[model samples]
Target: MTTQQTFARRVFLVAGIYGIAALLPQYFMEAQVGRDFPPPISHPEYFYGFIGVALAWQLAFLLIAGDVRRYRLFMLPAVVEKLTWGLATLALYAQGRLAVFVVGFGLIDLTLAAFFLYAFHSTRAERG
Candidate 1:
Protein backbone atom coordinates (compact mmCIF):
# COMPACT_ATOMS: atom_id res chain seq x y z
CA MET A 1 0.00 0.00 0.00
CA THR A 2 1.02 3.55 -0.60
CA THR A 3 2.02 5.78 2.31
CA GLN A 4 -1.31 7.56 2.23
CA GLN A 5 -3.16 4.26 2.22
CA THR A 6 -1.12 3.07 5.14
CA PHE A 7 -1.88 6.24 7.08
CA ALA A 8 -5.55 5.92 6.27
CA ARG A 9 -5.59 2.37 7.54
CA ARG A 10 -3.95 3.45 10.77
CA VAL A 11 -6.40 6.30 11.17
CA PHE A 12 -9.35 3.98 10.72
CA LEU A 13 -7.92 1.45 13.11
CA VAL A 14 -7.37 4.03 15.83
CA ALA A 15 -10.82 5.51 15.33
CA GLY A 16 -12.55 2.14 15.28
CA ILE A 17 -10.77 0.86 18.35
CA TYR A 18 -11.29 4.09 20.26
CA GLY A 19 -14.96 4.13 19.34
CA ILE A 20 -15.47 0.60 20.61
CA ALA A 21 -13.44 1.22 23.74
CA ALA A 22 -15.31 4.41 24.44
CA LEU A 23 -18.82 2.97 24.00
CA LEU A 24 -18.59 -0.53 25.48
CA PRO A 25 -17.84 0.59 29.00
CA GLN A 26 -20.89 2.81 28.96
CA TYR A 27 -23.06 -0.19 28.22
CA PHE A 28 -21.81 -2.09 31.25
CA MET A 29 -21.46 0.90 33.56
CA GLU A 30 -24.28 3.26 32.83
CA ALA A 31 -24.93 3.91 36.46
CA GLN A 32 -21.29 4.64 37.13
CA VAL A 33 -21.26 7.20 34.38
CA GLY A 34 -24.44 8.78 35.65
CA ARG A 35 -22.94 9.08 39.08
CA ASP A 36 -19.77 10.55 37.65
CA PHE A 37 -21.66 13.27 35.87
CA PRO A 38 -21.70 16.42 37.98
CA PRO A 39 -25.37 16.54 37.13
CA PRO A 40 -26.75 13.05 37.17
CA ILE A 41 -28.21 11.69 33.97
CA SER A 42 -32.02 11.74 34.07
CA HIS A 43 -33.00 11.23 30.46
CA PRO A 44 -32.29 7.88 28.92
CA GLU A 45 -33.07 9.07 25.42
CA TYR A 46 -30.08 11.32 25.01
CA PHE A 47 -27.64 8.96 26.67
CA TYR A 48 -28.75 5.93 24.73
CA GLY A 49 -29.06 7.96 21.58
CA PHE A 50 -25.45 9.06 21.97
CA ILE A 51 -24.35 5.48 22.40
CA GLY A 52 -26.30 4.45 19.31
CA VAL A 53 -24.85 7.22 17.18
CA ALA A 54 -21.34 6.63 18.48
CA LEU A 55 -21.63 2.93 17.72
CA ALA A 56 -22.82 3.74 14.22
CA TRP A 57 -19.78 5.93 13.69
CA GLN A 58 -17.59 3.10 14.86
CA LEU A 59 -19.09 1.01 12.09
CA ALA A 60 -18.42 3.84 9.72
CA PHE A 61 -14.76 3.85 10.67
CA LEU A 62 -14.54 0.15 10.01
CA LEU A 63 -16.22 0.66 6.65
CA ILE A 64 -13.69 3.33 5.77
CA ALA A 65 -10.91 0.93 6.66
CA GLY A 66 -12.42 -1.63 4.35
CA ASP A 67 -12.35 0.78 1.42
CA VAL A 68 -10.54 3.99 2.12
CA ARG A 69 -10.79 5.36 -1.42
CA ARG A 70 -14.43 4.53 -2.02
CA TYR A 71 -15.54 5.76 1.39
CA ARG A 72 -13.24 8.76 1.55
CA LEU A 73 -16.00 11.34 1.38
CA PHE A 74 -17.49 9.91 4.51
CA MET A 75 -14.44 11.04 6.46
CA LEU A 76 -15.66 14.63 6.44
CA PRO A 77 -18.65 13.66 8.53
CA ALA A 78 -16.36 11.59 10.67
CA VAL A 79 -14.24 14.63 11.36
CA VAL A 80 -17.29 16.60 12.31
CA GLU A 81 -18.44 13.84 14.60
CA LYS A 82 -15.15 13.82 16.44
CA LEU A 83 -14.89 17.57 16.73
CA THR A 84 -18.48 18.01 17.80
CA TRP A 85 -18.06 15.78 20.82
CA GLY A 86 -14.55 16.99 21.54
CA LEU A 87 -15.36 20.65 21.46
CA ALA A 88 -18.60 20.29 23.30
CA THR A 89 -16.97 18.31 26.05
CA LEU A 90 -14.18 20.84 26.29
CA ALA A 91 -16.63 23.69 26.43
CA LEU A 92 -18.53 21.98 29.20
CA TYR A 93 -15.31 21.51 31.09
CA ALA A 94 -14.49 25.16 30.59
CA GLN A 95 -17.87 26.06 32.05
CA GLY A 96 -17.15 23.86 35.10
CA ARG A 97 -19.98 21.50 34.28
CA LEU A 98 -17.66 18.63 33.34
CA ALA A 99 -14.70 17.05 35.04
CA VAL A 100 -11.15 17.11 33.78
CA PHE A 101 -11.11 13.33 33.58
CA VAL A 102 -14.20 13.46 31.40
CA VAL A 103 -12.53 16.05 29.25
CA GLY A 104 -9.84 13.48 28.46
CA PHE A 105 -12.33 11.75 26.21
CA GLY A 106 -12.79 14.99 24.34
CA LEU A 107 -9.06 15.32 23.94
CA ILE A 108 -8.99 11.91 22.33
CA ASP A 109 -11.69 13.03 19.94
CA LEU A 110 -9.71 16.10 19.02
CA THR A 111 -6.66 13.98 18.40
CA LEU A 112 -8.70 11.74 16.16
CA ALA A 113 -10.07 14.79 14.40
CA ALA A 114 -6.59 15.67 13.22
CA PHE A 115 -6.09 12.20 11.86
CA PHE A 116 -9.49 12.24 10.16
CA LEU A 117 -8.67 15.51 8.46
CA TYR A 118 -5.36 14.14 7.27
CA ALA A 119 -6.98 11.01 5.92
CA PHE A 120 -9.73 13.00 4.27
CA HIS A 121 -7.22 15.19 2.49
CA SER A 122 -5.05 12.29 1.44
CA THR A 123 -7.95 10.32 -0.01
CA ARG A 124 -8.71 10.76 -3.70
CA ALA A 125 -11.60 9.86 -5.95
CA GLU A 126 -11.21 7.34 -8.73
CA ARG A 127 -10.10 8.93 -12.00
CA GLY A 128 -12.22 6.69 -14.17
Candidate 2:
Protein backbone atom coordinates (compact mmCIF):
# COMPACT_ATOMS: atom_id res chain seq x y z
CA MET A 1 0.00 0.00 0.00
CA THR A 2 1.06 3.55 -0.54
CA THR A 3 1.95 5.73 2.44
CA GLN A 4 -1.33 7.63 2.16
CA GLN A 5 -3.37 4.48 2.16
CA THR A 6 -1.31 3.14 5.02
CA PHE A 7 -1.90 6.24 7.05
CA ALA A 8 -5.57 6.24 6.28
CA ARG A 9 -5.86 2.61 7.24
CA ARG A 10 -3.87 3.23 10.38
CA VAL A 11 -6.22 6.01 11.41
CA PHE A 12 -9.20 3.86 10.62
CA LEU A 13 -7.86 0.88 12.53
CA VAL A 14 -6.77 2.92 15.48
CA ALA A 15 -10.10 4.69 15.71
CA GLY A 16 -12.12 1.55 15.11
CA ILE A 17 -10.16 -0.37 17.72
CA TYR A 18 -10.28 2.38 20.25
CA GLY A 19 -13.95 3.10 19.60
CA ILE A 20 -14.95 -0.52 20.05
CA ALA A 21 -12.42 -1.66 22.62
CA ALA A 22 -12.56 1.25 25.00
CA LEU A 23 -16.34 1.27 25.55
CA LEU A 24 -16.71 -2.34 26.61
CA PRO A 25 -14.60 -1.81 29.70
CA GLN A 26 -16.50 1.32 30.52
CA TYR A 27 -19.75 -0.51 30.10
CA PHE A 28 -18.65 -3.25 32.48
CA MET A 29 -17.21 -0.77 34.93
CA GLU A 30 -20.04 1.71 34.80
CA ALA A 31 -21.18 1.19 38.36
CA GLN A 32 -17.69 0.90 39.72
CA VAL A 33 -16.62 4.09 38.03
CA GLY A 34 -19.11 6.00 40.07
CA ARG A 35 -17.95 4.30 43.24
CA ASP A 36 -14.22 4.61 42.66
CA PHE A 37 -14.32 8.02 41.12
CA PRO A 38 -12.64 10.69 43.26
CA PRO A 39 -15.57 13.06 43.50
CA PRO A 40 -18.99 12.55 44.93
CA ILE A 41 -21.66 11.82 42.42
CA SER A 42 -23.82 14.85 42.25
CA HIS A 43 -25.75 13.92 39.15
CA PRO A 44 -25.64 11.00 36.79
CA GLU A 45 -26.54 13.26 33.90
CA TYR A 46 -23.00 14.42 33.22
CA PHE A 47 -21.65 10.91 33.55
CA TYR A 48 -24.14 9.36 31.19
CA GLY A 49 -23.99 12.40 28.97
CA PHE A 50 -20.25 12.16 28.59
CA ILE A 51 -20.49 8.49 27.78
CA GLY A 52 -23.10 9.17 25.17
CA VAL A 53 -21.16 11.97 23.55
CA ALA A 54 -17.95 9.98 23.60
CA LEU A 55 -19.60 7.00 21.99
CA ALA A 56 -21.10 9.21 19.33
CA TRP A 57 -17.70 10.68 18.53
CA GLN A 58 -16.24 7.21 18.41
CA LEU A 59 -18.86 6.36 15.85
CA ALA A 60 -17.89 9.48 13.94
CA PHE A 61 -14.26 8.39 13.99
CA LEU A 62 -15.23 5.04 12.62
CA LEU A 63 -17.23 6.75 9.89
CA ILE A 64 -14.34 9.04 9.05
CA ALA A 65 -12.08 6.05 8.82
CA GLY A 66 -14.31 4.55 6.17
CA ASP A 67 -13.86 7.46 3.75
CA VAL A 68 -11.23 9.96 4.74
CA ARG A 69 -11.96 12.41 1.93
CA ARG A 70 -15.70 12.38 2.27
CA TYR A 71 -15.45 12.70 6.01
CA ARG A 72 -12.63 15.23 6.01
CA LEU A 73 -14.82 17.99 7.38
CA PHE A 74 -15.58 15.84 10.37
CA MET A 75 -11.91 15.77 11.35
CA LEU A 76 -12.08 19.38 12.43
CA PRO A 77 -14.75 18.50 14.95
CA ALA A 78 -12.82 15.34 15.78
CA VAL A 79 -9.84 17.39 16.75
CA VAL A 80 -12.07 19.56 18.87
CA GLU A 81 -13.46 16.50 20.55
CA LYS A 82 -10.01 15.12 21.27
CA LEU A 83 -8.76 18.45 22.50
CA THR A 84 -11.79 18.99 24.71
CA TRP A 85 -11.25 15.83 26.69
CA GLY A 86 -7.48 15.96 26.50
CA LEU A 87 -7.10 19.50 27.69
CA ALA A 88 -9.75 19.05 30.35
CA THR A 89 -8.02 16.00 31.74
CA LEU A 90 -4.65 17.68 31.88
CA ALA A 91 -6.04 20.82 33.43
CA LEU A 92 -8.05 18.86 35.93
CA TYR A 93 -5.08 16.68 36.76
CA ALA A 94 -2.89 19.71 37.25
CA GLN A 95 -5.41 21.26 39.61
CA GLY A 96 -5.83 17.99 41.55
CA ARG A 97 -9.43 17.77 40.38
CA LEU A 98 -8.88 14.46 38.70
CA ALA A 99 -6.81 11.33 39.26
CA VAL A 100 -3.92 9.90 37.34
CA PHE A 101 -6.26 7.58 35.49
CA VAL A 102 -7.95 10.57 33.93
CA VAL A 103 -4.61 12.15 33.20
CA GLY A 104 -3.60 8.97 31.43
CA PHE A 105 -6.79 9.06 29.43
CA GLY A 106 -6.07 12.67 28.52
CA LEU A 107 -2.60 11.84 27.31
CA ILE A 108 -3.93 9.11 25.06
CA ASP A 109 -6.50 11.52 23.63
CA LEU A 110 -3.74 14.03 22.98
CA THR A 111 -1.69 11.39 21.24
CA LEU A 112 -4.65 10.43 19.09
CA ALA A 113 -5.25 14.11 18.40
CA ALA A 114 -1.71 14.35 17.03
CA PHE A 115 -2.29 11.41 14.71
CA PHE A 116 -5.61 12.86 13.61
CA LEU A 117 -3.98 16.18 12.84
CA TYR A 118 -1.26 14.49 10.84
CA ALA A 119 -3.82 12.45 8.96
CA PHE A 120 -5.81 15.57 8.19
CA HIS A 121 -2.89 17.56 6.84
CA SER A 122 -1.27 14.70 4.99
CA THR A 123 -4.53 13.63 3.43
CA ARG A 124 -5.02 17.14 2.14
CA ALA A 125 -1.48 17.36 0.83
CA GLU A 126 -1.70 13.99 -0.85
CA ARG A 127 -4.97 14.75 -2.55
CA GLY A 128 -4.19 18.33 -3.46
Which numbered prediction scores highest in lDDT against the true structure? 1
lDDT of 2 by residue, 31-101 (tens): 78767984545777776677778888888888888778778778878888889989999899889889897
Top TM-score hit: 1
RMSD of each: 1.6, 1.9
What Cα-based lDDT does every candidate model obtain?
0.85, 0.78
What shift in Å separates residue 86 of candidate 1 from its native position after superposition? 0.5
lDDT of 1 by residue, 1-128 (tens): 77887799788977898799879778666687767763566887888888989999999999998888878888899999999999999899999888899799899999999999988877663312
The TM-score measured for candidate 2 stands at 0.87
lDDT of 2: 0.78
Instruction: Give candidate 2's error at residue 75 in angstroms.
Output: 1.1
TM-score of each model, in listed order? 0.92, 0.87
Q: Which pairs of residues have clashing backbones in candidate 1?
A: none
- Where does candidate 2 clash, by residue pair? none
Judge candidate 1 at residue 90 and give its lDDT.
89
Assess candidate 1 and give its lDDT: 0.85
Model 1, residue 79: C-alpha shift (Å): 0.3
